[model samples]
Target: MNDHCNRCVGCTVQECRHHSDCEDFCTLDRVQIGTHEGNVTMDQCTDCKSFDRR
Candidate 1:
């Protein structure tokens, strides 16, 4: 399954926009682009709750 809330190791809040009061908002586990065997992977922006799609 594709998870999008896994926390990253040594994530610095200074560069994060949600660092003020939402550290967990900028963390992800994995991102799924298509359905495939062992094709699931995590991305840098997937976990970020503050990730603006604009």
Candidate 2:
């Protein structure tokens, strides 16, 4: 959790290093989105490539 907040990016993932503890947003200006499945199917298959474990 952090004190910084990037209003454009709404995030609820507390495990991420970019996630803000005071607000439901990210601290990064930009985020990378990716998929883990061989064939993109559902939303669960998607992932935040910019995520860094806290």
Candidate 3:
């Protein structure tokens, strides 16, 4: 992920895909194979278009 998005405090990338409502563009469910707690795979964030390094 980029520094901008990563530095954004309280910015959960999951919210971008609206995982609470939809799962179509959500990469979380695909990579996350363990507990639904902290088992989220961050690779999804790197591929996110919203991730701005600037």
Candidate 4:
């Protein structure tokens, strides 16, 4: 994992390639957030666009 992963916040996607195994933090300093365009209305509507398949 990169050293920057230590500063990650609220990361839960353990399957992502950028996610650290030990600390469970994301390596990216910034993560792209987005949502489907149909009927989004809550925080659950958002998704981490930065996710990459591990």
The candidate that achieves the highest lDDT relative to the unseen native structure? 2
lDDT by residue (tens digit), candidate 3, 1-54: 322222222334454542323322332323322333355566543444443232
Q: Which stretches of candidate 3 lie over 4 Å from their true place?
A: 1-13, 17-20, 26-47, 51-54
Per-model clash counts, in order, read 5, 0, 0, 0
lDDT of 2 at 41: 85
Candidate 1 lDDT for residue 41:
62
Model 2 TM-score on a 0 to 1 scale: 0.86
Model 4 compared with the native: what TM-score? 0.73
Computed on alpha carbons, the lDDT of every model, listed in order, comes to 0.39, 0.90, 0.35, 0.78
By summed lDDT, the worst window of 10 consecutive residues in model 1 runs over: 28-37
What lDDT tens digits, residue by residue, belong to model 2 across residues 1-54? 378889989989988888999989999989999998999989899999999998
Candidate 4's residue-wise lDDT over 1-54, tens digit each? 544564646686889887877676888778888897578888888888999999
| Candidates 2 and 3 compared by lDDT, better number | 2
For model 2, what is the alpha-carbon lDDT of residue 42? Answer: 92
What's the CA RMSD of model 2 in angstroms?
A: 1.3
Off by over 4 Å in 1: 1-11, 21-38, 42-45, 52-54
**Candidate 3 C-alpha error for residue 22, in Å:** 2.3
Cα RMSD of all models vs. native, in order, equals 9.9, 1.3, 12.9, 2.0
Candidate 1 pairs with clashing backbones: 6-28, 6-29, 25-49, 27-47, 28-47
Summing lDDT over every window of 10 consecutive residues in candidate 4, give the lowest-scoring window.
1-10
